[model samples]
Target: AVMDFACPGLMGDLTSFRKIYAAPIGKAGERGASEEEKRIGAARRAELGRLTQGFIHARKADEINASLLPPKTEYVVFIRLTPTQEDMYIRALKQKSLQSMLGRCGKSDAEAPTSVLGVIQNLQKLCNAASLVEASDEFDIDASSKL
Candidate 1:
């Protein structure tokens, strides 16, 4: 007998689980899945459920142990961009390279997916710190609005 505890949300889709488990289940309803493949995948899923003894949801665990748990508090603070950071951000958005990568103009197909991802990463870095986007060795802590 096997017992497994998993959060349904974290488990993701069955296809993702199958990939992680390296199971022989074929893609179902995907672009390349034939009728036979779909049938095989469905059969395997059914068999998996049948073989499992039972399923349980410990939904009340937190409620039952409420006294032992500390109260949770969440705070969201908004910070405005620094003058230099704001200028850099506006310039970056207007750049032809970023525009091309985002498929807004120029030859978008000429750029690889990795290139597009790199641009996005750089933009995220820019949001954190202008120095990060510049890849400068000297980081001015005061320049970071979030800091």
Candidate 2:
């Protein structure tokens, strides 16, 4: 399993990680690491080993009890688009050119690649969420199911 926490030398491979990260930090400190630092490092390494072994044991226990595990369930939620949002989506499909879909904000020439890209980007943003494409204060976060 991948560990998401960012604490250096805090995983099962504590000694190796400490030798790479912690030891360097200790050496970089004003007077370098003293006996106290060594003691702390050893204590931390032992603690990590205990925790890692415990996690392994727990996972093994779970595997042994797999026959008693509950069946997994998946959920799907449906949301309807608001009337105004639906109108905007339909109007977006009927636009004749890139310049039109960009509204009055984009000033790129109609035939320019930037204008074409802007239209595509706008469509993508709309499909993902209206709030992502719309800069107006009235844009709602609830406008898209992906949110």
The alpha-carbon deviation from the true structure for residue 89 of candidate 2, after best TM-score superposition, in angstroms, is 2.3
Top candidate when judged by lDDT against the true structure:
1
lDDT of 1 by residue, 1-147 (tens): 123344444444666667633253547646788888777777767765554435643457778678777887799987777887889989999998777667743455555577877877887888777888786787688895556
| Each candidate's clash count | 0, 0
Clashing pairs in 2: none
Error of 1 at 78 (Å): 3.9
Badly placed stretches (over 4 Å) of model 1 are 1-31, 53-77, 99-121, 145-147
Which 10 consecutive residues of model 1 have the lowest summed lDDT?
1-10
Which RMSD values do the candidates have, in order?
8.8, 12.7
Would you estimate the TM-scores of all the predictions?
0.50, 0.30
